[model samples]
Target: MRQVGGIIFIIILMAVMFLMDWYVYQAVKTLLPDNNLVVGKIIYWTFAAGIGLWIGFTFFTIMREGHISTRSQLSLNLFLTLFVTQLTVIIFLFGEDIFRTLNAVYQYLTSTDTGKAASLPSRRKFVSQIAISIAAIPFTGFVYGIFKGKYDFRTIRKTVYFKDLPEAFDGFTITQISDIHAGSFTDYDAVKRGAGLAAAQGSDLFVFTGDLVNHKADEIDPMMDSFAQIKAPYGQFSILGNHDYGDYTSWPSREAKQKNFQSLKEKHKKLGYELLLDESRLIEKDGQTIRLLGVENWGVGFHAKGDLEKSLRDVGQNEFKILLSHDPSHWDEQVKKHPKNIHLTLSGHTHGMQFGIETPVIRWSPAQYRYPNWAGLAEEAGKFLYVNRGFGFHAFSGRVGIWPEITVIELRKA
Candidate 1:
């Protein structure tokens, strides 16, 4: 049954990709001048060839890696096909006009329109394109280097005086890190850097909000020492994310997946973290109690398996609560309106995949639309949500505006 379902999903995904590719090709072709048949053909063929080569190369590389069998090759191939197709589509959609406009400006500058070239719309467009492209080349190279280097580590600290903090937990500081996808693109250096940054904050408590590994539990074996360095006075706690469940990749059996999860939880224990799965623990300070609730991956339409109600069952309603949830959507739909209001929710499933500028006034990530409170701090119904951008890079293996974060949150009283 699982095999059948997987096959059907692959079929649907491939159909969508083909349709998208066709749509983008037709759209771009329509925008070009009808007289420029050669130019249009060249553009279309070039894009097609680039996409084809990318797909072929990806498959060849995967086969060479020998991690997955040919029987499962279709699944991997589909991912590569879609990724490359989308990348090509975006390049043509955004790059074609810029290139054309630049060419026109260069022609005008070298032609008879020297005085008016500065004022002409075409000239302006050309100059803007040239400037942008020139700037983009180095920026793109830097981003590529970061991706290849797999060094997406950053620290964010905010000061909250002891007076501003809740009476129960004054001078309390929490280090939150999330989305350490420890697989092909991540290593001990990245983890060490993240831990070093977190440790430098001098946090009292450390919280890792899921996605410790990309696929399997064993994948984290290499980074155990680095992760162990992340220690705080209070304790370190963690929850499971969707990726941590090993859903994206195939396993031999359900039992295997369960075993992997159990092993991962055990690994977290070894790393000095109390792995919370629909459970809560209390931290007492100066005779006051604060509850820390941790739940498994639960999100709308994705994975809604986490049981928050069960997790918070033992805790008192008035106690200040901090929840570690993997998906920000959990806070939006469940945590905000719970019978006992969770004072703060920390999540990190969204790695801000499409990290870029929305406009001059707004700097945003694509995850923002999918998740109401996607990144940074947001408040709703008196409850606060801090969605960490993530501590490691994924799939595309890069970070843009939404860089990897080691969030040091200082709790304060209202």
Candidate 2:
């Protein structure tokens, strides 16, 4: 029964895709010279065929395996991204053909050769050229995003002043990164460079807000050395994110899933990070002490395993506290209102959708509509939340305007 349903779904999807491909073909035919039409046909058919193959493979996995692995899932994501982005650009080109078609119909009805009559001005030659010219901008941007932008890691530094901060920790610095998504990385040197940059900062402390791997624990094994490069005298601390639970991929049994998670925790250990699961640690400098709390993945609608209250049970009210919760929504739903008075919260799950615009004056991403605190820093009352854009890309395999981020936050006494 499932096989029958899957076949029917694939057929319907292929039909819709073919119709869309026809429109793209028609748009290109109108502008290209006769000699160029063969080339255009080749380009259109090749892309259309690739999409059809991926759709079939995706349906097959859903029926047989129940869930696709992170690598195959990302292939589907990249295919759709190229399909939709190019589809948008060509839709404008199709509009020009619509006007040309209307003009042709007008010309045939008027029969201007035998009558001294004015006909609707024929579509100008430059109109088709202009449409094609404009379509190139998005095409170029997508190419750059896939090849260059994803690896363009940048460090963002913010100095946060606190009037009530203890003087002993006033000049302390903390480094943070989130959403490693190690399974999605394809380039070794680029990945090493980013990790090397984070380690070079030599901050007083380092924290990794999670999503360490996309699905499997083994993904980080090959790159363990690069991540281990990160060093701080205070040591590194980490928490899990939505992807860490092996929820996105199929497992043989419940026991297998549990085992995978245990292995993932061990991977963090290999990377020199102290895996903090619903816990708090006290870091002392001179005679002053501050609390560092970490909780498991907690988001508005995701795996809400994080226990903020349990982690803070041992913490005192007077001590300055930094909480590492994987998702920013935790701040909106729990962290901010908690009576513990968490001074700082670090999170990263949105990844700014791995594409967006950020500048000194303006910051924006489609991810913001779903997560108000999608990127950078935001404060409410006296509490702070810093969303670390992300340390790695995931399904789409690239970043656009919002590149990978390594966040350095400095604490100062006001």
Candidate 3:
């Protein structure tokens, strides 16, 4: 009887998801009048059926096995089903466009003149099509998801030798880990592994650039021990990301959200991190002082409320400074052109959610085009920005070419 009720509940949930998909498809189709309605209908039916079967099978498998099943067969099936469906929909929607783009690429390659090549459509279309096809596959999304959920680790280790050193802190190593979205979906073991990885990187200082939890601070309370493991001789410091403010979900009032933010700040302190909210701290090394400044989420056209100037007001203009900001846009708009030079800015709001190929020269995330300095080390006008891909997964629950990043930056004197 219990099994029957459970199955019924699963069916209802599946029906809801299918209806949602159908509604979305209809809404989208209305925008493309020239689109093949037959193909759209076929795609919609395929998606609905695929989602239904996937959800149904998942529930059945769960019923057959105990709550803590080791096989993970059902999960795999569900993942594959979603992946295949996504692939099918992508192909259905963009198959002709991809073919056309490929033909254009072939023509460009076969052509002789530089002008002809210049006139040729940039490889963006073909590359985007291929990337979409790859991501559409269940194997790709599922495998990446498994690794991201399990490992809780990714790193960028680049040897950047600086010609000049700052008198205060030459050869300073900073370890930055960001976007640890601890919540209902993230496994405890993964969090533990992530903290372990962060601790293993021997650095003078540790910084968590933000997005501690997906929703509420309470969601992260159980995982405090995991986070506590991240420590350094100097200290572990943090700043708030947009999500840390709890704006996505409903809070009874503005006061409630403020309370939640305060709780998250306290939680960070409890985990042995100095929560820097529009504030600055000085690190003393070798009898010289370097300033560390952190700001609230301030992005152009998004949340441009963070006071970068105010945060750096107390710090000396000539002091070597590192800024912990959540949004990369902040670096582009404010820090890059600020009268007082900021040496290095670390951020990780762009989880590289759509992690895949952008072009021959670039592995792209949707975040890249939106922000000037989207990922990796981007330098403009003598300022350096390193955008960590992120420490954890969100929304789609996967990582592809843009894997979860753990950045170990060796700050050199110039």
Q: Candidate 1 on 148-241: residue-level lDDT in tens?
A: 4336566777543322234868668899999887774434665677678777887889999998887788878888888888888889999989
The weakest ten consecutive residues by lDDT in model 3 span 65-74
**Candidate 3: global Cα-lDDT?**
0.72
TM-score of each: 0.73, 0.85, 0.70
Per-residue error (Å), model 1, residue 328: 0.8
| Clash totals, every prediction | 3, 0, 4
The candidates, ranked best first by TM-score, are: 2, 1, 3
Error of 3 at 289 (Å): 1.3
Model 2 spans > 4 angstroms off: 1-20, 34-43, 59-74, 77-81, 90-128, 360-362
> TM-score winner among the candidates?
2
lDDT of each: 0.72, 0.84, 0.72
lDDT per residue as tens, model 3, 1-414: 987888788788677666546534533454433658778777778867875776667667766552313234445445544645455555544554566678888888887866775233433334444444564574555565555533546767744444434665666788898888776344677677777887889888999998898768887887889879888888889998877878656667899989998898899989999988788998987787888999988877655557887888778878877899999988877788998988789998887753555456967566767776677888887778888888875554556566677889987665
In order of lDDT, best first, we have 2, 3, 1
RMSD of each: 8.4, 4.1, 11.8
Please give the distance, in angstroms, between residue 6's alpha carbon in candidate 3 and its true position after superposition: 30
The runs of at least 3 residues in candidate 3 whose Cα sits more than 4 Å from the true structure, single-residue gaps closed, are: 1-47, 50-138, 146-152, 159-164, 358-362
